[model samples]
Target: MFRSVLVANRGEIACRIFRTARRMGLRTIAVYSEADANALHVREADEAVLIGPAPARESYLDQARVLTAAKATGAEAIHPGYGFLSENAEFAEAVMAAGLTWIGAPPASIRAMGLKDAAKSLMVEAGVPVTPGYMGKDQSPERLKAEADAIGYPVLIKAVAGGGGKGMRRVDEASAFLDALASCQREAASSFGDDRVLIEKYILSPRHIEVQVFGDAHGEVVHLFERDCSLQRRHQKVIEEAPAPGMDEATRQAVTAAAVRAARAVNYVGAGTIEFIADGTEGLRADRIWFMEMNTRLQVEHPVTEMITGQDLVEWQLRVAAGEPLPLKQDQLSIAGWAMEARLYAEDPANGFLPSIGRLDHFVLPDDIRVDTGVEAGGEVSQFYDPMIAKLIVHEETREAAAQALADACADIEVWPVRTNAGFLVRCLEHQRFAAGDVDTGLIGAEEAALTDARPSDAVIQDASDLLWRSRNVDPNDVWDAEYGAPGFRLNAARVTRQTFFVDGVRHQAPYENNHPVVRYGPQIDGGFVVFHGGDAYAVSRHAPRGAGGGGASDGSLRAPMPGKIVAAPARSGDAVTKGQPIVVLEAMKMEHALVAPFDGVVGEIGVSVGDQVAADAVLAVVASTS
Candidate 1:
């Protein structure tokens, strides 16, 4: 085994790898950006090094800086923990050239599967069932239009070079294809530096299932079962579970076999994931499943697989990277239980899932479940990176039990200051269709409103009111005439204090009690400040609200959701735009966001041009009210 390994990444994933490395008796080195100087990963590592500035391009993405960190730290191997430069073949090659072991797939394997168009072509040739689409090298607009026409409407335009739903668009009709193609191309260029795209038949209601595979240097490969990642939004997975629900023995065998084949075809080593889009409309079937893509590094949702497999995937990656043979064959691997993982993101799900940035004051996950997180309380969530807070994972003997457990755990999770999708995740898990195992990629989108619509019960509102009354004075026994000296409170001997505070979009009138030594609103609010108001009270620390500016809002225009560069503005001043019409496309955290017209009107002013970096709530444009 390698004596030491350098992790070329930051956040929870780096910490995750370090834990396994330490357990396996290997020294671990952690590299971090300036933003992550005091991050958990750095504190957990045996050694730490500063890479560069906060921006990924200047730091984590800097290959030379990572190599220098590895060399200076005296690490024998480098582990690219997902994201940043994990899948970049150039970085993998550089690691090997630096005379250090690359704790991941071979550089050649990464290169082979780096490009989506190229990977799909290879999979098709290898006899893996690929989605029927145009995967040709032709980049002509006319040719793509022709392919879309030939394949019929509702085609998908995907970037050839990157994944994570970046540079991807779904057009339901042929009339919308051209505009979507240009938009996708621009997003592709902005995100991956590659504008090349490929048209594919858009699969409706597909369940994303990926099988994890591991290989060793000695050519021994084995499958580690599969994970169901059907719940998603904007093509990004929100929830994932292992031992896919309702999967039969035959289909399981076929999917696992195809995944193994894909792994061996690339002469892959270490850990990799073979994603397949399964037809959920008619339920899952071996024949209806098609190859999606192969993630050449440890996946973000690997915890679910670990929960079910009872094995450390990171440890295996280290062993394989150290030129060890497979520890067990495929036959030895068996799913022990159902495990579900919910990605907790710092974003507003109701407001088009816009990323939110702030200090996490109250960060608490359930003790009963396993939570893999990168951020801690008081940590600032910057706008420069992905707004993921943590991942909550739970394991149970049955799928129903696991789903319920996850829902309960999510409800118990208290994260304040930054809005999260925890409530949304709980609703999804409790959703009837999801509970029944009838899920698809469109599940979240289809039930977007209900999933995000979090409302405090009457009991909760009552509890808040009681808390408000009690917090009026430091001395609970103070009379109504007595000075109720406290912030957000005043001595109101003549009248009840009425305040309007939002809880899960529900406006509540919390009438403070005028005289009450014993505070009570909700039955459970006897001792604490409103027992379940929104997320968690301990998680609620007040901070200055983000300033709203940007765009042109003289007549009240909707602003940009978060900080990002304007990649596309199809509308200009005086152009008529209807509600929901695409006005501007903002690229942030390596994801494209479409700012649609709030109401039917003519574009009064366009404040930003392409390539403009905007701050959160910065108005990009204003629309004159047509009504």
Candidate 2:
């Protein structure tokens, strides 16, 4: 089944594992970096290499340049498509010591679920329940605060080595448990150099719910069910779903038989997942679920479990890495509908969601759901990686019609020179406690100002300026064009260029009439045009820019959004700051950024110094306002 596979990973999950290894006829090989050389999964691979430069530890976590570009493109097998070096257990024992075919799972099951304190002690000896707290290995801080005061006052200091919420920490009592365990041991010793920690039990309304296990190499295992992912933010996962909204039927068959007994107690194979943490205060039961960690590979919401198990988990991870086995066990897996996904992320849900790099002018995403994307319409979303940029997904037959068709396909998705959340994921699918599904992980920090309110609507800015003035062909009875109303006057004075735009929170201005079809803007902008008027409807559409060598306006320099370090700055040089104060904090991907004061300021230039590595907007402090 595997003629050539080599996808080691790049964007849109290396074009989503080369579209299931070219629909099973295999032959893929991608590997880029140099900020994904003109990306789009390196122009949809068949072969492509250059595996280095542009960070990600010198190129997608190097590992001998992805085993010499998978044996110089002979490939055979190797599809780690979920975050670089997919659960690297020494790069899956260096692709099974270079003989190829390591299509995932088994580097001793990614080193027995690669360290979340030894996979919660192997999911409590595979009875698979976990999450009680203190998986013990004593890192003495008064015995981890007497085991978080005998597992009571709101615990949770994770990070027994890398997982998104980077070295997590919660501690809601006993005076914030020794400064959140010294800031979760300095962010788990600067992100998984392993500062070792484990104290759980802070499940106060958690939801996550993962499952979707699969296996083969003949030991067989199956479950392909569950995937709620509780729409999180800091604990990563931006949105996901599939058979989970109030799941019943005997707790979804005891959480899919304890996620196929935690993937047959890690003899697991191909497409993994597990991750539980359920108990939403008291809802999805199977004795209130637990075990929170076991991704191993393939799950950046694997297309909402492949749109509710219609199956194609990377062509069943290349038909179980070419030795096929369990094709339909676990009673032929069936869920059939309701799927969702979201995760668009160029980042800027009103700036706290940070991470937004540049150039992607009018990338237009959403042609009826299922996006996936690796950046197009001219790419460059760089900041060295993981700004996500696409995922969308959707499928219906329920779950409130797949959350109202992913909120009308994210209000008709459209990205322009970088700026999206697609209107903050259409206000988190019209929020109201996420349309009353009562999700958690602080549901976007509890409706974060109505989901980063960028506020758009004077009828959606007169329909984004009458769809940008009928895409610039604005002919209002063409009297020599300009919308046909110009030449007015006895005193030769017809001024109208009063711009002041700000939609959603409303504040518009468009006083254009200096001449014909030049009327500021308005007419239910749904497909394009958006003439300005100060109230902010500039939309316009079809620009297609990408790295912007010419299209300007985003390089003034203000970097650092995820990937931390640089705690506290109070910008000095002429200090006058105002527009949203707090001047410099950064500290990358593990979250904590401030670098504010964008307007009404005075600190003209500071260019990062407190241990600077800055990327996302790279120019630390350069205010200069009084325009």
Candidate 3:
């Protein structure tokens, strides 16, 4: 084993890697940018080094800085913990060149599977089934259009060098081809610095199934079963499970064999994932599955596989990088139990799932399950990185039990000031279709309204109101005395005491009799109170009365919903736009949000330009009534 290893990443993955390294008695080093100076990963490492500024390009993605930090810290190996430089073939080669062990697949393997088009061609040549698509090099717009026409409508335009759904668009018809292509290209160039893309036939009723494969220096490879990651939103996985719900013995053997073949084709070493897309319109079978792509590093959802197989993937990575043979042969590995993982992100489902950035005033998770988190109570979710707060994983004897436990765990989370999809996740897990395992990639989209429309029950709302009233009126110094009125006399009065609050932007007034029993409240943090009742918790903030001079902007103003950079301003000043027409596109938290006009009107004073960063609620443009 190596004496020490440096984690060339940030957040939960960094912390996760450190845990395994420390358990193995290996010293761990962490590298951080200015934004993550006080981050949990930095505080947990044995030694830490500041690399560069907050932006990834200046820090995490900078190969020279990372290599220097590793060398300075005397780290014998560097673990690229997914994302950033994890899949960069050049970075891997550079690490090897510096005489430092790279705890990832060989650079040759990474290069082989780096580009989508080239990787598909390689898979085809290797006799592995691949999705039928256009992998040509022609960059002409006409050529792409012709390819799209040949592939038929409802084709997917994917960036040649893209992952995490950044540079992907689905075109339903020829009329939308050019526009979708432009948007896909723009995002691809911005994300991967490669605007080139390929057209693929979009699979309807698609189910994403990926097999976890590991290889060693001795040309030995084995499989760790599979994970069903069909629950997705915007092409990004939201929930994942091991031992796919509907997978049978015959299909499993076929897919696992194919995955091993794919790994051997590249002479792959270390941890990698072979993702396959299945046609679930009928049911999971051997014939309907085709190779989609391969992730050349540890996956975000590897924990589910870990829970079912009773193994640490990071440990495997370290052992293999040290030139050790395979830990176990293919026949030795087997699934134990069912496991599920839900990615908890700091995003608001009510607001089109826009990313929320703020201090985590009250970060708490259920104690019953395993939670891999990056931020704590006082940590900040910044705009410079991914908004995922944590990954909640649960295991049980059965899939239904695991799903229910995961949903309950999500609902039990108490995070304040930073909006999350916790409630939405609960809804998804509890949905009838999801519970029955009748799911696919389009599940979330098909039931989006129900999944995102979860609201607190009336009893929970009343509990919050009661807690707020007691906190405001009851004196902590003297429990017997009431600040508003005498306890006995107030109870005799007929009028009710009204307490106002804003629960998710909607104003609510709770009227209660003075004699009403005081409801118990949890610890108060940052002037906000968390109320618990009926086995549920609600975080409510007192809505202070608007002071004088509050009335300001008109209702027709199109404001930036959150702090972000203006990527495009399609409607200029004096340009006429219809209701719901997009005025500007804002980029934040690595996603695009389009701000649209509130009503049919003419565009007035455009306050922001392309490439300008604006604060939350800052008016980007005003839509004056046409009448």
Candidate 4:
């Protein structure tokens, strides 16, 4: 067995791996960037090393530095905790060549499943059902478009080398195929250094069902059931649960068996995921589900699988790396109950769901649920990494109970200044369709406006108003002076103070009254009270409610949604534009956000060009209104 392990990653997963390693009595080592030097994960490690600066390319993804740190720290094994270099086959081989254990799938397995096109071919040869798509190697734009035509409209163009929802696009018609393909290829080239792509028939009602598979060197592989990650937005998973709802035993058997077959085909070892996309218009069936790709590493949502199966996946990985036999035979393991996990990200849903980065002044997660995070109250969410702050996991006897518990936990979260998607997550979990188990990948997109509602209810307003009134000082001898038009008291009673607050940049006016309601409020920050209602933070502050309220008409300037690099400027100066036409596509935090035209007008000014670095609120273009 290995005596020490170094995690070649950052954030919650690193902390998670350290926990299991410590329990097994293995010395823990953490590698951090300069930005994460004071992170919680570093503090939790027995030994920590600084690899490089803030940018991941220079820090977390620098293979040589990570390997050197492991060697210097006497780490017997390197656990690439899911991201960074986890699935890099060459890096895995390099670790083994350096006479250190690599705690992941074999290099051969990673190479076999590295590309979507090649992996799908492998799955087909393994006698597993794969989605109907094009995996041919002809990279010509015309050939790809023809393939899309044959596959029919509404086809998905996915990068052969993509993961984490990057390098993917959907085209609904033949005319739009080329443009979407160009964007997809550009993203793929930028993200994965591979511009090659494959096309798939877009499942209108799709459900992301992935099975967790573990293999040992002794030729044994077992499935840990399946998880439904269909609740998604922009191809990114938002909520995931174990033992997919409405999954019949027959379908489960078929999917799990196929997943095991896929793993055995590559002679895989350690942990991996076999992702399948199901035609979910009908309930999950053996025939409707097919293989999509294989994630040859641990997933971010592995905790729910752990909760349901009652097993430490990291322990399994360690044992497998040490050439141990399977912990339990296929027949011995079974699901204990239902489990759900919600990713708590530092992002603003109202502001086009842009990543919010700053010092976390008041980071408070619920204690009742199992919360895993890598940042504390005084920590900062840097601009150089993913925005996910924590993960909230819950387990119950049934799926219904688990969903409700997880929703309540999300609502109880209290984060200030740095906005979060807690409110959006709560809506998704508590949605009536979600509760009924009638969900698909488009559920979030279909109900995004309602799910991302940034407004607080009337009751919340009343509660905030009451608190604001109580917190203020009332003068004892102020008379109602009508001549001077001053706000004061009458002879017998006091006039209600007009409580005004600025919420979401809009002024909310209400009378201050003595009424109590169950409302959660965060600590005072920047002279305002943060009212946490239904998972949304309302930064309420006095605005005086004076004059004819503030601003006027629009200037039609489109600004950068967040700090990012402008990848494409589709709209040039003097171009005719519509209200929602795509003007600039900015890539940030490993995802693409399209900044569109504000209203129907002509593009008067183009402030950014392709490859230009931009900051949040930096004007990218201006539209001159015609009407």
Candidate 5:
């Protein structure tokens, strides 16, 4: 094994790689940008180096800086931990050119699969089933439109160089093709610097099932079963599981064999994933699944596969990079138990899942399951990176047990201020359809109402009120202080101390009286207290007194819902726009959000333009009531 390996990434994946490297007695080096100077991964590494500024282009994605840090730290190998530079073929070659071992697939293999159009062609030649689509090189808009028409409506316009759902749009008709193409192209150029696209038939009932494939320098390849990544939102995976719930032995064998064949086609080495889109309208079958794309590095959901197979994939990567043969043959690998993983992101489901950036006031994870995270209590979640807080993985003897355990863990989280989709995740796992394994890529969208309608129960609200009352009156120095009656209350008369709170935007008042029994609140943190009641926890902080200022703007204003860059301003000042017409496009957290005109009116003062960064609640434009 290499003496020391430098992790050329950030966040949880970096920490995860370091853990495995340390266990193998290999020294680990971490590279960080200014934003991650005090990050947990930096603190955990044996040695750390500052690469560049906070922006990814200046730091994490800068090849020269990463190589310099690795060389300066005397790292014998560099592990690109699944983002940024993980799939960059040029970066892989450059690392090898610098006389450092690259702990990933061969640069040739990466190049082969880097472009979707080319990869699909390669898969077809290798006898792997592929979805019908257009992979032509003609860049004319008319050509793409014609192809879309031939493929029929409801076709997917996908960036040839895109991942993580960026640069993808689904067009339902010819009338919408041009607009979707423009949006997809803009996103593609911004994300991958390549606007080339491919057209594919959008599967109505799609189930994303990917097989984990590994190869060695000795020309040996093996399969590690598969993961069901069907639970998704906005084309991004939210939950994943191993040994797909409805998978049978025959289907598994067929998919795994196809995955190995795909790996061999590229002479692939190290860890890679062959993702397939299955038609689940009927049921999972070998013939119904088709190749979608291949991820050329360790996946984010590798933990679920690890739990079921009892193997450390990172260890395999290290050994293979060190010129070792395959750890085990395909026949020796077997699924042990079912496992599930839920990605907890710092995003608010109530606000259209907008990414939230702030300090973690009271971060806590369940102790019963495995949590892979790079942030801790008091950690700052910066706006320069992905907003995923952690990946919670659970294992059990059965899929139902695993799902229930994962759901409970999500509900048990006690994060404050920073909004999360924890409640939504819990609902997804507990939903009748999900529990029965009738899952698909559209599951979240179909059941969004149940998943996101998380309102604090009355009992929870009452507990919060009581806790707030006690926090103000109870003396911290004296635990038995009984002077905790509501202020200005007499001995016999009933007094009601009304406290107001906003839960999901709606205001609620809970009254507390000195006559009622004191409800114990948890220990106070810096900014808030965590209250538990009726098996649910609520993070409560005293609301700041409202000022005399007017309650925000009227419905005529188009304000930014979150901090982001203004990518487009279609309606200029003095331009008339109809209600629900897109006026501004804000790009944040690698996704675009369109802010529309609230009513039919003429645009007035335009406060922001393209390429301007604005904070949350900043008014982007004003619409005078023309009605």
Candidate 6:
């Protein structure tokens, strides 16, 4: 094995690779951007290097800086964990050419599987079933439209180089195909620098099932069972589990066999995943599953695979990179128990799942089970990268038990100020259809309202007064605290010491009394305490809106929800606007959030001009009600 290894990625995946590298007695080097100077991965590395500034392109994706860092730290190998340059075939070749072991798929294999169109063609040649679609060189809109029409309605327009739900669109009718195709192509070009797209027959009930295939230098490959990534939001995976809920032995064998074939077709080595899209209208069947694309690096949800198989996949990667034989034969692996993982992100589901960035003042996660993260309390979730905070994973003998246990764990999360989708995850886990093995990609969108309900219950809000009262009157050092109705003690509320506060800018009041424990909240900060309950943060403050509010109020004001640059201001001060009409585009965290009109009104103000930088709550534009 290589003496030292440098991880050319950031966040949880980088930290995860380091854990295994340390266990294998290898020196670990980490590269960080300016924003990630205090990041957990940098702090935990044996040696760290400053690659560039906060932006990813200047740091994580900077090939020259990464190579220089590795050479300086005497790192014998480079591990591109996932994302960023993980799938960049040229980067892989550069690492190899620089005489460093690239602990990932070879450049040849990466190139072979880089484009979805090419990969599908290879899969077909390898006798692996592929989705019925068009993957031709014709870039004309007419050809794409013709392909869509032939494939029937509800065709999937996918960018050849897309991942993480980007550059993808589903058209349910012929009329929308052209528009969807145009949008998909534009995103693909902007995101991957490749506008080429392929059309596929959209599955009515699609379930993402992928097999973990590891190949060794000895030309041997083995499968580590399969994972069901059907539970998704906006094409991004929300929850993933091992031993797909409805998978039978026959289907597993067929899928795993095809996965091995897919890997072997490209002479693939190291850790790779063969993603298959299954039509789960009925239970999983071999005939219903087809190859989608291949992920040529370790996956974020690899923990669940480890929990079930009792194998260290990172170690496998290290050995393979060192030109070792397969760790175990195909027959040696067996699925043990059900494992489920939920990606906990710093985002507000109710508000279009926009990224939430701020200091994690009171971030706390459950101790039991497995929790993987690269951020901690007191750390700032900067608007320079992805906002995934952690991954909550659980393993149980039964799938039912795993889902419930993971749901409870999600409910136990306590974060303040910065909002999250923890409550949404809980609902997803406990959803009747989800619990019954009726999983699909449309589950989140179909049940978005119930899942993303951000409102705190009447009882929870009623108990907020108790939290505020304790924050003011109760002493932390007092061991002899009053219990419910114990010697002049009162439960819920004894005296109506009315306390007024605005939660998310809306005002509410409740009687002050001791309602211990049910309503948990962080200590007083920025005017008032933030109620942390059921994995949701309700910003409660005694003060009301000051002047022209910006932090996204129900008013017709369009504000920079977070610190960002104004990209476009389409609506003028005198322009008439309707509710939800796009007025301003605020760019932050590598995402563009459209600040839309809150209600039907006339545009009364345009606060920020294009190319202007603004603060978290800075007003961008405003649309006043006609009344």
Instruction: Return the top candidate by TM-score.
Output: 4
Off by over 4 Å in 6: 174-179, 472-501, 512-516, 542-557, 564-578, 583-587, 599-627
Q: What is the lDDT of candidate 6?
A: 0.86
Structural similarity to truth (TM-score) of each candidate:
0.90, 0.32, 0.92, 0.95, 0.92, 0.90
Q: Compared with the true structure, what per-residue lDDT tens digits does model 1 show for residues 353-397?
A: 878888876677777678887788888788888888788899999
> What would the TM-score be for candidate 4 when compared with the true structure?
0.95
Spell out the clash pairs found in candidate 4. Answer: none
State candidate 6's TM-score.
0.90
Number of the top lDDT candidate: 4
lDDT measured at residue 507 in model 3 versus the true structure, 0 to 100: 71
lDDT of 2 by residue, 504-601 (tens): 32345543332333224433334334443211224444332234353111332355554546755756778887776767766654455556675675
Question: Could you tell me how far off, in angstroms, the CA of residue 494 lies in candidate 3 after the best superposition?
Answer: 8.2
Question: Stretches of candidate 1 above 4 Å error?
Answer: 473-507, 510-554
Name the lDDT value of residue 616 in candidate 4.
Answer: 78
**Local lDDT at 93 for model 6:** 88
lDDT of each: 0.80, 0.73, 0.86, 0.88, 0.87, 0.86
Candidate 1: residue 231 lDDT (0-100): 90
> How accurate locally is residue 572 in candidate 2, as Cα lDDT from 0 to 100?
76
- Tens digits of per-residue lDDT, candidate 4, 1-627, equal 989999999989899999999999999999999999999999999999999998898989999999999989999999999877898999999999999999999999999999999998889899999989999989999999998998898999999989988889878899989878888888888777789999999998999999999999999999999999999888889999998999999999999999999999999899999999999988999999999999999999999999999999999999999989989999988998999999999899987788998888988899888998999998998877889999999999999999999999998888988999998989999999999999999998889899988688888887876676666654313344331114645457755456567654467877655677657877885556778877888876765323335322157877776788889988889999888888889888877788787789898878888999988779888888888
C-alpha lDDT (0 to 100) for residue 54 of candidate 5: 88
Candidate 5: list runs displaced more than 4 Å. Answer: 468-505, 509-554
What digit string (tens of lDDT, one per residue) describes model 6 on residues 505-571? 7788776445555667666767777776777777777677464264354776666778877766767
Question: How much is the lDDT of residue 587 in candidate 4?
Answer: 85
Each candidate: RMSD to true structure?
4.8, 22.9, 3.5, 2.6, 3.7, 4.4
What is the overall TM-score of model 1 with all chains considered together?
A: 0.90
